[model samples]
Target: MVETGTGTLPTYTETLPRIPESARTARRLVDLALTVWDMNEVRDAAEMVVSELLANAVHHARCESVRLTVTRLSDSRVQVSVVDRSRAHPRRRAAGSMEESGRGLGIVNALAHGRWGVDSLAWGKRVWADLEVTSGE
Candidate 1:
């Protein structure tokens, strides 16, 4: 089940199929949440990070289910996380030009602004990125 905070800040989460479509679904969810929170300023970066995270989960996690979560930590900060039923940790690879893959983590790192990480869970692992929301957002 998904969890949402009742006081001050709110969190939204959902479990999705570990299929290719989930990546798109993740973007839609992030867009909707940012819209509702009046955080559209960070929408582009958030969506890009979410796409990379979800794509990584679907392609590398080797699990049947994935959980996507968006948390509003404060008025100026938000976090997006993906949990997969795989224990394997992901590493960033050095990809050359014309390489179609192996740059998911790199993208996240570049866009997350030094605020992304992986946490080992009892059943699997959760990868998350923290983005700074603009005040006027």
Candidate 2:
């Protein structure tokens, strides 16, 4: 079972298969949540953040499925998280220009403005990033 963060704020979540195609579903989830919250300004960054997080879980986690969550942390911020049955924490690595991979976390970090981290669960881990909607949005 997934906790919806005390049920205080609006949230969207779905359990997705551990496949590449699920990333698209996760992105749509984020888009939907942000749209409903009237936070479209951060929709693009939130979508990209969720995509990277979901891609990492799909490619690296040894599980049948994963849980994706999008929670409104505040009026100006939202949290995107991916939970998988893998305890191994994600690592950020340097990728060369010619490399086609190893840049997922880098993109998450940039888009989230360093407001991202992983939480260890008894069954797995939750990787999350916070996207803030700037003023005048």
Give per-candidate clash totals.
0, 0
Best by lDDT: 2
Decoy 1 TM-score against native: 0.91
User: Could you give candidate 2's per-residue lDDT for residues 82-131 as a string of tens digits?
Assistant: 99999999999999999999999999999889999999999999999998
TM, every model: 0.91, 0.93
Q: How does model 2 score by TM-score? A: 0.93
Candidate lDDT scores, in order, read 0.87, 0.90
lDDT of 1 by residue, 1-137 (tens): 35588875688899999998888888989988888788788899999999998888889787788999999887778899999989998899999999999988998998777789999999999999998875654
Ten contiguous residues minimizing lDDT sum, candidate 2? 1-10
Runs of candidate 1 with Cα error greater than 4 angstroms are 1-3, 7-9, 135-137
